[model samples]
Structure formats: structure tokens, C-alpha cells
Target chain A: MLAAARDAFAERGFEGASIRGIATAAGVDPALVHHYFGTKDQLFLAAVQAPADPEELLPEVLAGGPEELGRNLLGMFLRVWDGPARAGGLALVRSAVGSEWTAKLLREFLVARVLRRVVGTLGYSPAERDARGALVGSQLIGLVMTRYVLKLEPIASASRESLVEAYAPTLQRYLTGDVVLPG
Target chain B: MLAAARDAFAERGFEGASIRGIATAAGVDPALVHHYFGTKDQLFLAAVQAPADPEELLPEVLAGGPEELGRNLLGMFLRVWDGPARAGGLALVRSAVGSEWTAKLLREFLVARVLRRVVGTLGYSPAERDARGALVGSQLIGLVMTRYVLKLEPIASASRESLVEAYAPTLQRYLTGDVVLPG
Candidate 1:
């Protein structure tokens, strides 16, 4: 069922990959899928083995002073990518890069689960918040692609501490600094 | 020859795709490829319609004071991406994401043509230079992926000026700011 879910998500994306379709692909009843995983979202979360639970993790990272949020956030990201869950994280990125469906799934997951929660804590206008979140997303996503998936040198070889130091300030700027947005 | 080069690049990557192979695929003599394009690298530049001649453009971008370098770099990037050359840029990024071969190709191009030249202008140690180059590559590549390929919101809709304002500082930081490197 999980394999079916992954294939379905890879091929059809989140909106197109229905529970019934997944069940059919798995040669199981839709009820079986429901029994195993309460909902499609749950099923996806389970199948992707999402590297970290944003709800559980973001609070801890965001607990520090706002200025420290960027460092803390990057620290958390590095840990997740370097931890035992690295395989799952890598798979998710590879899949996301491969198909629009997976990209949308990953985007929805990041924006809804992660970015919004982080940005929502800061009292910015909706436009500002959205722009900031997207900026942060671009930085982190690029970091992971070069460091892990593409394994670009220097980044792949740099110590976690170095990355944290080098990137935290940039992330910091995205999180709280003044940015010019479309008026 | 150009189509064959594109397909070969997409399928086999920079390292694996041979001039002989591309020539065979194109049903042309290998000498013809060498005569027309000069080298595989030149062939790729031709096939992808690379945004600008890095040698010519990078000097212009890097010409000003260091503080202004980030804005100039990003401004140039946006022009290449938002201008008539956008399709080629988008195709190169898509191909890079889809295959490791292309990723390596793109990486080499960025590192050799763009990042190294920019970083080389700064008087950092080789290790520091490599690290900074990789860091800048991550941000720019990520920007293109989200903005052009994935079409992530806010970023997708963002004005070129807005993005330049939002991201140039981050790039500036990577280029010349104090980043703690691994000892």
C-alpha cells in the first residue's frame, strides 16, 4: 500500500492520487487503506516518512529569541538531513524534483505544515509573510539540493558547524530583516 | 547535432555523454561536431542557449564595488531568466534536476564559468572560495527551481526588482561577509 501510494504520488501528484486509486493499485479495498491510515494525508505522511514532524519540531526551534530563529532553524534542518532519517529526506527531494505531483505535495507540506507555522508566529502582513516564507524556502531547499542530493563539493564536505554559521545569517535575514516586496 | 547533444546530455550527463555518441545519435560525423562546436562544452552552451557568456557578463557584474556585486549578480540572473533566453534556462534547470548527469554538467558550468570567477575575485583561501561558491550556487539554483521550474507562489509572482531586493543581501553575505568556516 505504501509503495502504491509513493508510485501514485510520484505519477499523479497529491490532488490526483485518490485513496480509491491507491487502493486499487495496491489490490486492496479502500476500507483497508482507511483502516491502516486514517486519511489520505496521514497515508502520505506515513509513506513519505517525512524527515521530521514540523508541529513537534518547529516549536522547539522557534523557542529562542527571534534573532536566533535562523540559526536554530538551520541547525534543525542540518540535523534532520544528517541524521538516520537522511534516506527518507533524500527520497522525498528526489521524488519532488522528478514530478510536479511530488513537487506540489512537498510544497503543500512545507508551506502548510512548516513555513506558515514559522512565519505565522511573526506578525507580518499576509503578503510579507508569504514572501518571507518563500524566500526562506528557496534558501533551505537549495541548501539541501546542493548538499545532499547533488552532493556538490565544499557544501557536501563542509562541517555542519560551518554550514550553520555560513547560512544562518542569510536565513536570519529572510526571517526578520526588512525586504522590499511588491506594493 | 544540437538535438542529439540535448538528448545525450539529458540521458547520459556531462561525463557520460561522448561526442562520438552524440555524433552517432545525430547521424553526423564526429569531426563535424568538433569542427562546428569546437568542444563538448561549447556544444552544450550552444544546445542550451546558455543565458550569457559568463566571461563577458561576470566581469560586468563583478566590476562594481563588492557591496553592489550581489545586486548586480542577481539583476543579471533575473534578466537572463526573465528575458527571451528563459526557455533555455528553464530547460537546463529541469534537465539538471531530472538527471545526475545534467546536474553535474550544470554544476561544472556554474562552478567554472560563474561561481569560481565571482569567488576568485575575492581573496579567500581556496577552501573558503570553494565553500562560498557552493553556497551562492545553492541560493541561485534554488531560486530558479522554485521560481521557474516549480513555480512556488510569491516567488513565482515576485517582481524581478523585489527578488533582487529580497535576495541580493543574502548573496552579498555569502560572497564577502564574515562566515565561520570549518577550521
Candidate 2:
């Protein structure tokens, strides 16, 4: 089922891949798939070995509210990557870089499972919200790649709060500042 | 020689790895290596399959002087990734993500061959300069990873100028703004 789910997600993305279709590909009943994973997002998480759970994480991460959204999001990201989620997160990143299929799955997971939910709470127009999400994604991806994968100096060794304090403003701007929207 | 260059670089990094050592590993004279590759930078470029040449690029990239540095740099980056350098750039990124050695080599190249020279022209404390470089690296890595590798929407499809206009601030801020220096 997991393999089938991965194949489905990789081939069709989150919006295109359906629970029923995934079940059919896996040779399992649709009810069993739902019973096993709860929702499409949950199943996608299982398929990709999700680094963190958005459902459980989004509220806690956002509890600091709008002003601290950037700090909280960045801090939460630092924690997730620093802990046990490190290995799985590394694996997903590694796989994504090499394979287009895996990259799409990773994209679907980030956009559908994570960024959209985080950006949804903001009262911006849909277009503004999406551009914000992409900006946020770019910074996070660069930070993670350098600190964890490349282990770039000072950045890799910097304390989490220190990084959060130093860098959170960049995120804050992207999330809530008067950023230029796409034409 | 290229394989030997890769090994030496991956193990000892750009500064640490010498032509003599690479040549020794390849069972050739140091002069022969230098004769063929010209300089250590060129050798490293061939070894890693550099997406673009810094020597050729830095002058034009930084020609806008300090005021327009961010815009010029980002514009240059978008052009490089959107052109023939795209495949080699993608290959290097993919390999780096999966291998620690490759990641180290990448860090060394970015720091020694590119960032240091770019930052050196400005008069600042070494620590301040280093921090700025790291911050710039974080954003550029993120942009390339998403725009080219992951193909994150709007970002991937965004008009080059729109992206440059939207993103140059982040880079400019990191480069010239009063960024918080590490203690």
C-alpha cells in the first residue's frame, strides 16, 4: 500500500492522485486504505515518510500567533530537523534532488500538507498567500540544505535561537510584509 | 585526473586540497595537472562540473557596484540556472544532497571560489563578511533547489525580473543591511 501510495503521489501529485485510485493500484480496498491512514494527507505522509505532522504541528507552531509566525515556524523547523526527524528528512531531501518523481512527491507534501495550511490562516488574497508560501519555502530549503546536508560553517553550528533571532525577520517579511506579488 | 581531483576535493576541500596531492593520487606530476587545468580553481571547476565560471561571472555579476549588488547577483543566478549551466548545476546539487563529501566540496567551492571574492571587495570585519555570505548562500541554494530542482510553481514559472525584483531585497538585505552579527 505504501509503495502504491508513493507511486500514485509521485506520478499524479496530491491533487491528481485519489484515495480510490491509490487503493486500486495497491490491490486493497478503499475502506482499508482509509482505515489505515485516515486521510489523503495522512496517507501521503506515510508514503513519503513525512518529517513532521502538519495536523499536530500547525496549531502548536502557530500558537505564537501572527507576529511571531516567522520565528515559530523557523524554530519549529530547526527542532524537527535537529531531532529524530533528521534522518528521514535528510533521506527525503536526498531522494528529491536526484529523482523528478520524488521531487514532485516532496513538492506535493510541502505545498499540500504543510505550506498551504500554514499560509491559510493569514487573511491575504489567495495569490498573495501563494507567493508568500514560495518565498518561505525558498529560505527554509536553503537553510536546511546548508546546515544539515552541506554543514556550512557557523550556520551549521549556530544555536537554534540564535538562528531564529538572526534570520526570522527574513521569514517574517515574506509571510507578512509588503512583498511584491506576481503580475 | 578528474576522478583524482574529485577525491582530493571531496576529502580535503578546495583550500586544503592541492594540485600536488591530486596529481600524486592520479600518478602524475603536479606540473602536468597545472599544465592541463591552469589553476586550482579551474581544476576544481572541472572536478565538480561547475554550473558557471566565477572568474567569468563575478566581474559582470558585481559590476553594478555595491548598491545594485543584490539585483545583479540574483539576475545573474537566474540566467545561469535558466541556461545551459542548468544541467550541470542540477547534477552537482543532486550529488551534494546525497553525499557528505560532495556537500563539503560544494561548501568549499562556494566559499573559496565565489563568496569570499565577492565579499572581499567590501570593507567589513571577517566575521560580518562570513555571516553575510552564509545568509546569501542560504537564499540562493533555496531558490535554485526549488526553481530548478523541485520546480515549485510560480517560483519556477515566475518571470525572471519579477523574481529578481521580489527576491533582490532578501539578498540585498543579507549582503548590505545591518544584519545581526554572530557573538
Candidate 3:
């Protein structure tokens, strides 16, 4: 059912991928889809998939303290995207491009589950946290777009460790460093 | 003719938008479009649009040297997009999304025309320069996506000066910061 859901969502996008389509793709009755998932939104979420609950992971990430925050965050993200299953990252780019609902789902997941927890734990003002969150999100999303979607040259060729070494500090600056104006 | 070409390309996407359709829209001879643009590729470029040659702007930007590179580049970009003429930016994004040839145009304009010149003036190692270039390109492209296409909240609402202040330092970092890992 999940596999069918993935195909339907991927091929047809969120609006076009109806519960009936998923049911038909899975060779199950449409009523069974309702019985199993309750709603199309839930089914769509299930289809694109998330490896773990970010809410659970984010708190533990911050518990090590703010100093290691960038490394920990980047490392965790790198692990997920660079690990055996890379679908989450690709599906995410597709979602960001596809529909407002998926983009909202992504933004909520990032803000509530991942960023808010980490930033809330930090001793920064709302503006600071928002700025930092935006920069970090931009970097990570940009990295994924280049590495996974566009597969642009050396970036795609870069090893996971190399990427972390190069990028984590950029994240760290957003996380902690003072903002310096361009001269 | 140009108006028909633009609408067809924008609506149907590059592959889907045909010269015949454009001709039909324009109420002109198809041979006229062919005579004017020469090929579909050239027509796509015409449809996508390019700004004043980055080459023309590069010398002025680099005149202040590396110290002010970030400010100049980001400022020039914002001015271009915010000015009376932003159809070019819109065309660029539309083409980048819609067609490979158009993406090549973006790469040439973005990577070769804009980034390579700026990074070339900087003295980073080839590998480092490439990575840095990608980061800058991603941020700028991401800015266009957020500000122009997706019309996301804070970014869309952000004043030009506010955005320049917010983004310039990140661009500066990508341009010349030592790639250090978080402690």
C-alpha cells in the first residue's frame, strides 16, 4: 500500500493522487485505504516517508549543548541523506517543487520538529533565531538540491565527510557566530 | 511574436511549447519566428531572457575589489530584480525549471558569467572556489525562488535593504571564509 501510495504521489502529485488511485495501484479496495490511513494527507505523508521522528531526535541533538550543535545537526542530516536510503532527500525536493501542502508539511516539520527545538533551547532572541534558522535551512536545502537533485559536478562527487567538514562551520556561523557585514 | 513565444513557453513549458503554437498565438507565419530566432533553442533563449550582460556589470562590481564584492554582487542582483525590469529574472527561473537548454543558459549566465568572474578575482584553490561558487549560486537562486516564485512570507515581505543586509554576509562567507569545522 505504501509503495502504491509512493508511485501515485510521485507520478500524479498531491492533488491528482487520490485515495482511489492509491487503492487501485495497490490492488486493494478504496475503502481499505480509508480504513488504514483515515485521510489522503496522512497517506501522502506516509508515502514520501520520514526516517525518524525529528521531534525526538532534535531534543537529544541539543542535549549535548550548543557548542556542538552545528556538527551534530549536520552530521545527523548527512547520515540520513548520505546513508543507504536516499529517497527522503529527493522526495523532499520534489515536494518543495510540487505543491503548497507538501511545502507546508516540510516547513512545519523543519520548524516545529527540528529548528524550533534547537533554537528555542539556545539563548537568543526571536529575530536571531529566525535568522539563524533561515540561513541553516537555506544551506542544507541548497546542499541537498545540488548533491541529490541537480547532481552538479564536484558537489555530487564529494564524500559525506568532506561535505560535513566544509559545510558544518557555515552552519555553525549561523548557529553562533557574530554577523559581520561585507566590507 | 515575442509575446506569443513567452506565453507559450511559460504555460506549456519548454518541451511542450511549440513554434507552431507560438505562431498560432502570434497570428504570424511560423517561418517568421524561424527567420527571426533561427531555431527552437534560440527561441527558448529569447523566451527565457537574459539581463544586461553580466560581463558589462562585472568590471564595475570588481572595481571595488574583493573587500566589497559581496555588497556589490548582492546589491546589483537586488537592484536588477527590484527594478522596473524583473521579467528577465522570471524568465530565467522559468527556463531553468522547464528545459535543459535553458538550464545551460542559466549555468553560463550564473556560473560562468557571474560566479566565475567573482570567484576568479578571489584567490581560493580551484576546489574551494568551485564549492564556494556553488554555495553563492544556490543562495542567489534560492532567493529568486523564495522572493519571486514561491512568494514565501518574511522573504517576500523583506525590504530590499533588509534582505541585502541579511544575505550579504552569507555570500561574503561563501566567497572567502576559511572552511573550518565547528569546534
Candidate 4:
């Protein structure tokens, strides 16, 4: 049923997809879908199949506050990749790379589920929060591309611990420092 | 001849393509291929295509150094997008999204031509340089996704000038600053 929903979502973007369509594709009655998952968004989330809620992960990560947030995020992401959650990580990246629906799904997961809540916790203004979020998003997305998607040489082969060490401080600054603006 | 070469390169990638094959596909003499392009690299460059060369544009952009580089790069990119050169950009993005050969071409262009040469001018180390380059690449690629491919609201509705104001500083930071690393 979830696989059917994923195919439907991938073929027809979020806006184009319908609950009825998913129900039909999954070989279940519409009421069955309603009983199993309450809303289209919930069904879509199930379809994408992420291992864990980034929202649940973010607070525990930021519990350390801004100081070690970068390190924590990197460490957590590495753990997800190294563990049983590897398929989930791959799905996120593949979806992000695969089609517009996947990209939209990934974007929503990043913003609504992760960035907004975390930035709210930090008590930043909208602009500051978004700027910082984009910075962090750029780094995380780039790392995934380099390490997993592109599979470039030494960086691709490097230990996850080494990458965390190399990248954490940069995330720390984006999170907390007054880095100079480019004129 | 050029069309066949472009298709072959797009399908097979840089290393996988051969001058002899391109010549045979084009129904041209192999000697003619050698005569025109001199080497496979030269032919490959012609096949892959691009907007303006960063080499020619970068000096003009950096003429005012760190202060105006953001504006300069943004302006340069928009001009390329707005001009007849957009075909190369579109072709490259479409290819990168699905085709491995095309992705290799793009990765090479980013790392070797654009990133290495342009970012290297800033005098950072190899790792630092690649990281910064990757960030800049993602931003530009993301911009393309929103503006041209996905046609997202606000971003598509945005004026080129407004986009420059909103994005140039971030681009400038990726080009020149200590970027935030992911947790």
C-alpha cells in the first residue's frame, strides 16, 4: 500500500495526487485508507518512509543549545546512514534527486519539521532564522551529494567521524557566530 | 557532427566517449574531427557547452574584490540565464538530473573548471576550496530548480534584481566565508 502511494506520489506530484487515487492504486477502499491514515499528508509521509521524525530528533539535538548543534546533527545523520536507517537516508536523497514531489517532500521535512521548530527554539527573527537555516541546509545537502550521491574520492572514502570533526565547527558558526556578510 | 557529439557525450559521459565514435556517428572523417578540435578534451568541451566562461567573467566580477563579487556573480549568472546561452544551462541541468555521463560533465565543470579555478583564486586549501565550491554550486543549482525547472512561486515571481539582493550575499559567503557545517 505504501509502495503504491510512493509510486503515485512520484508520478503525480503532491498537488496532483488524490487520496482516492492512492486508495485505488493501493487496492484498498477509500474508507480503509481513512482508517489506516487520517490525511493525505500523513499518507504521503508514510509513502516516503523516512526512518524517524526530524522534529523528534531536532530538540534532543538542540538540547545542548547552539554550542554543539552542528556536531550533534552531523553525528546523528551519520548514525542514520551507518545503521538500519540507511534505506531511509537513501530514500530522502533519491526522492530529493528523483522528482519534484520528492524535492518538495524533502523541503517540507527540512523547513516545517526541522528548521522552523529549531529556529523558534533559538529565538531568532524570521530573516536571521531563514538565513541560518539556508546555510545549514546548503552544508548538509552538499555533504550528502559529495559523500553519497557523487561518491567523490577521498571525501567519499573518509570516516564518518572524520567528516563530523571537519564539518561540525562550520555548522557551529552558522548556528551562532556573527560571520561577516559579503558586500 | 556537433549534435551527434552532444548526444553521445550526454549519454556516455566524458571518459566513455571517443573521438572515433563521435566521428562515425556524425558521418564525418576521423581526420576531420582531429582537424577541427585537435583533442578529445576540446571536442568534449564543445559538446558539453556552458554559459559564459567564468574565466572571462570572473575578473570583471572581482574587479572590486570581496565587496562586489556577490553582485557581480549574480548579475553574470542572470545574464547567462536571460540570454541565448540558457540552452546549455537547461541541457546541463536536465542531463545532471538523470544521466551519469552528464553528471560527470557537470561535476567536472564544477570542481575542475568553475570551483577549482574560480574559488582557488581566493587562496583557500584544497578541502576548504571544494567545500566552499560545493556550497556555491548547490545554491546556484537550487536557484535553477526554483526559478526555471520547478517554477516555484515567489522565486519565479521575483525580479532579477530582488533575487540578487536576496541571494548574492549568500552566494558571496559560500564563495568567500566560513560556511556553517551540518550537525
TM-score of each: 0.79, 0.95, 0.67, 0.67
Estimate the overall C-alpha local distance difference test score of candidate 3: 0.68
Question: Across residues A21-133, which tens digit of lDDT does each residue of candidate 1 receive?
Answer: 99999999999999999888788787666877777788788889788999999998888889987878777777776667777778767776778789878899887887888
Better of 1 and 3 by TM-score: 1
Native contacts conserved, per model:
0.56, 0.56, 0.11, 0.02
Which residue pairs of candidate 2 clash? none
- Scored by CA lDDT, what does every candidate get? 0.81, 0.86, 0.68, 0.67
DockQ for model 2? 0.66
**What lDDT score goes with residue A98 in model 1?**
66
Q: What is the lDDT of residue A142 in candidate 4?
A: 59
For residues A32-90, write the lDDT of model 2, one tens digit per residue: 99999999988999998887787788888799988899999998899999999999999
Clashing pairs counted in every model = 2, 0, 0, 5
TM-score of 3: 0.67
Tens-digit lDDT track of model 3 for A1-183: 988887666556556678997898899999999999878866765665655556555765776788888888878887778875576556565655556545555654455456667767777776667566765676676676566654544666777777778776667777887653211
Q: Each model's DockQ?
A: 0.45, 0.66, 0.13, 0.14
Evaluating just chain A, the predictions reach TM-scores of 0.77, 0.93, 0.67, 0.72
lDDT of 3 by residue, B69-104 (tens): 887888888888887557766765555554554554
Kindly list the per-residue Cα lDDT of model 2 for residues B14-58, writing each as its tens digit: 878999889999999999998999999899999888878987989
**Greater-lDDT candidate between 1 and 4:** 1
Q: List the residue pairs that clash in candidate 3.
A: none
Candidate 4, chain B, TM-score (2 decimals): 0.76
- After superposing all C-alphas onto the true structure, candidate 2 shows an RMSD in angstroms of 1.7
